[model samples]
Target: MGNTQIGHTDFMSKVRLTDRYVASVSPPPGGRIEIFDDNPLGAGLILRVSQTGRKSWVVRYRNEDGEQRRFSLGLYPDVSLAEARKRCIQARLAASDGVDPAGAKRRRISERRSRIIKTFNDLSLVYFAASECGEWKPRGKRKRPSTISGEKWLWTKHIKPSLGALPLEDVTPLDIKNLLRGLVDKGQDTSANRVRAQIRQMFNYAILEAEVATANPVARVPMMGEETPRDRVLRDEEIRLVWRALGDPGSLTSAQGARRANQRVYVSRPVALAIKLLLLTLQRRHEVAGMLRTELDLDQAIWAIPGSRTKNGRTTFVPLSPGAVVLIREAIRLADAGRDHPSAFVFPARWDRDKALTPASLTRALRDVSKALFLPSLTPHDLRRTAASHMASERLGISPLVIGRILNHTSEKGGAAAVTLSTYALHDFMPEKRSALIRWDKLLSEIVSTRL
Candidate 1:
C-alpha cells in the first residue's frame, strides 16, 4: 500500500486515462498522490497532479499489442475520486482478461451506433453513399458525379423515406413486400421495382461493411406482373389518338378515367415535349436526362451517349430526326433556369439539378402524355417495346443484331458479338435502320392522328 495521503476535498470529474479517474478534488501541483491500495497490476486508479493544482485519473494496463496501455477515466474536481476509482476497477478487470479497455469502449460506441433507431431516414445516408460507390469512373479509378447524382436521387426520393431507419437485422422480406405493394397501390411499378433493387443493394452493404449479418430481405419480394413504363409504345391507331389527344382535352377522358388514372397528370408543354422525346429517341428516361452538350453532333445528326454515363455501359449513337434535333435544341434552349444551366442532360430533374432527369419524372411525364393523348396506357419503356414490335413487324423487317445494338440488349445467350466478329460491325446496315426509324416515326405520327 502507498502512503495514505489525503485526496483533495473538492469534487472532480477528470479522467487522465481509461480505468483511471480523479475525484472531484482538483489536485494541487506536483508529485506523489494517494492511489488505491495493492494495485500491483496497475488496476487501481491514479491521479496525476499538475502545477496548476488540477488532477486527472489514468488506469494503466497491458494492451492487446502487449504494450502498457493507459485508459482515461475523467478529470478531477469534475469526476469524483470514488467514481474514477470504480471505473478503474471495471477497466482493470477488462484489461486483466487481455481485453483492451479502449476496445471495450469502442465496442460500446459501436453498439450505441447499432442501437440507434434506423427510421426510414437514418439508413439513407449510408445507403446513398454505397449507391454512389457503384457508379462509373471518369478515366478509370475516379467515379463520375453524374452517376453519384443518379443514385442520390433514387436514395432521396424513393428509398430513404421508404425504409431508411429500420434495423439492418430487423428488416424482413415482408417489409420489402409491403413496400412493393405500396408502390403498386401508387401506380408506380417501375419505381417499386427500382426501390426493391436499391434496398437489396443497401442490405448487402450493411452485411459486408457495417458488420451487420442479415439476409437481403428485399431480394425475396415479388413484383406485380407488369412493370409500368411511362413509355409504353403506342400502337398505330393508339399513337394517332395519343397524338390527336395531345391537343384535345376531351378525348383524354378514357385515359384520365378511374382505374388507371394514376398513370400521370400534366397540363404543360414541357411535359408534352418530354413525352415526344421518349418516342423520338426510343431511350430510357435517364439517358435523355443526362444528355450533355458535347454528345450531340448536329452536323452528323447523331446524339451520342458515352458508355460510362449510359445504363447499358456502352456508347450509343442515336440517329436524330430533324424533328428530334429540333426538339433537342429547343430543350437545350429552354434549359431549366435554376441549376442545370451550365452542364448537360436534356430533360434535367429539378430536385437533383446536377443530373439530367429522374426516372420517376420521366415515367410520370410519359404517363401523362399517354393519358392526355388518349392512347392505351403506355409506359416510357413501352417505347422500346414499340420500337421492337415495329422492327419485328412482318411488313418491314430489321435484323436482330442491329436491333440489339440500338437497344443495347445483351444477347439472350450472352455470347453474340463477343465470339462472333461479324455481328459487332452490323451498324453498317444504316439504310435499313434509317428506313425503319422513318417508318416507325411516321407510323407513330399516324397513330397519334387517329380518332375513336
Candidate 2:
C-alpha cells in the first residue's frame, strides 16, 4: 500500500518568505497548513492556510500580562510578505512596552469618531439653546424671537457655511478674520461688524458654559470698522411730510394708490397709525411692532412694556399723551373693525392679522413713507433720538433724568451712577415722565400742525 497521510496537517520547516513559495503552497484536505517565516523581524509571523486553501498573515506574541494572543495583519499577496514583516515587528515592540495593540487600535478609531461628532455645527446648536433660554445674559431674561431669529440667520448664512464642519477646537482666529475681511472687501463693513459680534458671543458661550472650547476664537479680533453715528433728526417740515404721507389720501404715492393693490406692498392704514405711535412714544421699532393690545391701559393713558420687550430687559411704563391716546384709540378701531373680538397685537401684521407686526414690515413701511414724501431717509430709531433731544432741551425744561427714564436709557450713564440708578433707584419716576411726555406732545402737535 502507498504511504498515506492520516490527516491533512502539514508542518513546514521555517524559511525566509518568498512570493514564488507562497503561491505554490496549498492546504491539506480538511486541515490547515502553517508556514513560519525565518526573518528575525517576523519572529512570530505565520502564514495561515485554512482547510479551504485561504491564506492570511498573523502574528502571535506574549502580552505584558504574559498572555498569548494573536493579531491578524492582513491577507497574503494583499498584505505583501514584506509589509506583513514590518507590521509584525511593530506589534512585538508594542507588546514589549506594555501596550495592548488591539485596544490601542480601537482607541484611535474612537477618537476619530469623537472629532466628527464634536464639530462646530454641533456646538453652535448647544450654544443656541442656552442663549434662547436666557442663560447667556447676566439678567437671565429670554431673548426675543426676532433677536434669536437674526442669530439663526447669521449662523446659517455665514458661520455654518465656512466653518460648521470643522471640529470646535480646530477653528482658528485666522479663519474668522478671513471671513470678516471678505465681508469688508464687499463693502459690508457694518454687516461684518455685526457678524463678528454674534460669532464672538457664540464662541464665548461655548467656552464658559459648554466647556467645549479652551479659548474664544473671536475674542481677540477687533470690530471690523467704526460705525458712523447717524444724527439725522427730522426737521419740522420733514415731520409734517411724514405725517401727511401716512395720513392723507392724496399724499399716497402713485404706486401705493393704484389699482391691483395686492401687487403693491404699501403700508396699510393700521401700520401708518403704528408709525404715529412710534413718533409719539419714542419706542424702538421692534418694541412698537411687537406690542400687544393687552399691554395697553387706554383709560389710565399708560402702555406698559414688559421687560422682555425692551432692549434692556426691564419692564417700562410709558405715559401716553392725550394725542397718543387718540391715535391708539383709532388704531384699536381699525384693528377691531370686521373682527369677532379685539386682535391680540396692537399693530397686527397686514398679511396675518393674528400676529404682531414684524420689524421688517415696520421698516418697509417707513421706507415707503420716506420715499413717498421725498424726505431724507429716516428710521424709527431716529424718532427715538429726536424725542430725547427735544425733551432734554431748555425750551422743554424736562430734566435729563426724567427723559432718561422715559427712554429707558439705563446705560446712558455708566459706572457707579448707572449701577445706582438700576439697583437702588428703582423708582419709576412716573409723574415726572408723564409731565415730560405731555410737554413733548404739545411741541409735537405744534410741529405737525404746520402744512409744509
What CA RMSD would you report for each candidate?
Answer: 16.6, 22.4
Error of 2 at 216 (Å): 2.9
lDDT of 1 at 419: 50
Candidate 1 lDDT, tens digit per residue, 348-387? 5555546665555666655666655645656667766776
The whole-model lDDT of each prediction reads 0.61, 0.79
Model 2: what TM-score? 0.63
Weakest lDDT window of 10 consecutive positions for candidate 2: 1-10
Q: Pick the candidate with the highest TM-score.
A: 2
- The runs of at least 3 residues in candidate 1 whose Cα sits more than 4 Å from the true structure, single-residue gaps closed, are 1-120, 134-166, 172-196, 214-233, 247-267, 336-343, 349-355, 372-375, 411-432, 442-452
Candidate 2 residues lying further than 4 Å off, grouped into runs, are: 1-119, 138-141, 156-171, 248-265, 350-354, 371-376, 411-428, 450-452
Clashes of 1: 51
As a whole number from 0 to 100, the lDDT of residue 186 in candidate 1 is 86
